[model samples]
Target: MKMKCLYVAVAAAVLSLAACRSSKDAVSVNDLDGEWNVVEIQGQAVQAESQPFIGFDAQDGRVYGYTGCNRLMGALTLSKPNKIELGQMASTLMACPDMETERLMLNALASVKSLKCSGKTLVLYGADKEPVMLLQKRFEVVPLSSLKGDWRVVSLYGAALPEGMETVPALNFDVTANRVTGNSGCNRLSGAINHDGADENSISFGNVASTRMACPDMDTENQVLSALNSVRSYGLLDNGRLALMSEGGTIVLELERSK
Candidate 1:
């Protein structure tokens, strides 16, 4: 109970000094569907590199998203038109160098009383009905849970692998352990994954180590390792495949969740 109140205080204390803005979009109350990327808090632009986002599932009566530092989730209830109330919130315990963004986000969210969402953009208002935060709609919100389990390698740099290849490289995401274990198609692959689970398609691999084994598929293994090392973010495709994107937004590695 105290922690919850602390969040409210954090938001109120930080946001009270922000210059308020009037709503300019058409009134669309309680239209908090889909995923949204936090663009601004109290008119202060969030760093472009940080991926802070939120998702609302009204039908499920829940809210979830990645804070700038950790994964956060809670309940949602809309008791009146244009009105909102967030239930107690819970989040992961990971700490980061810069937690100000997360603090601003949580503080602003806790103070949200009403909002004007125009389907593409949302402006959250505080108790004074003054805008506290701005959010832009994002396409295809990927749940962290979706990254779990085994994924079969489908393509390398968008090119399909040789047909009938016995050794198919794969990736396994163990979110709980914060580790990635899989095959480079020739060597056993293991590594650490860095993700706040918030930035739009935000994820990266680090300290990847693999067993040295001579195989005819070493070329494939090399390509896979290079791809994994270069991964910058991830995306969920309409076809239900997970795309491990590289620098400049290239789909270096494509994966399908194993059945």
Candidate 2:
């Protein structure tokens, strides 16, 4: 009887040590300290939109990443043994023209409950649909500063306007002023904005009230209204192209600053 008890105690100690190691290997912010890309989003198709995921220190034991359209930051807590929870992530106020795609990415990340490593792929899933963030391991990121300036629009979405409606006209957005005051296709218009000084990426046009001008091209007029009302996020991309991308790479319009 005494010999059996000794063996049982030794076995328990070994099991406990193994459990500790497993828990340590679980997913945490420390493990996700580098860049990542969206290899597979929402368990549907795989679209690697953002090249490199940028993770920066939030000074609060959390990590932040730059999605193609918006800034994402969240908390990570690793409970014992296969139990993990990715806290609610907060994003900047940029209305994506492609609302569908942006919503999917945000929803996936928000749904991360527990994560596991499958070879080189890091899969994140939830016990339920609470939050879902599935990301693949990625490499370094190249910081670009050329993406800064006033951009204009080239295209838009939504319904066509009446004969005299201006959805959105030729716009010249000044990031320095944190304002987007420009010609609304026909009339002069202006509104507030928020700029990312480091990258010139900005957002604006919430509740923009413009002068009711009667233009010959009602399409332009209706477009002007849609642009202001639907303006969500804006970014300065390569080649001096300022893209006002909506919910899903939907380029509401692309404009160039005056050289």
- Top candidate (lDDT): 1
RMSD of candidates 1 onward, in order:
12.9, 12.5
**Candidate 1 residue lDDT tens string, 146-215:** 7989999999976888787777999999988879999988789999988865564678889999999898
What's the CA error at residue 224 for candidate 1, in Å?
6.2
TM per candidate: 0.49, 0.40
Q: Candidate 2 on 31-145: residue-level lDDT in tens?
A: 4444445665766654444332434232245656655667777776654334555678887777755556567777676666666544334556767733245455443222223
Name the top TM-score candidate. Answer: 1
- How far off is residue 183 in model 2, in Å? 2.8
lDDT of each: 0.77, 0.53
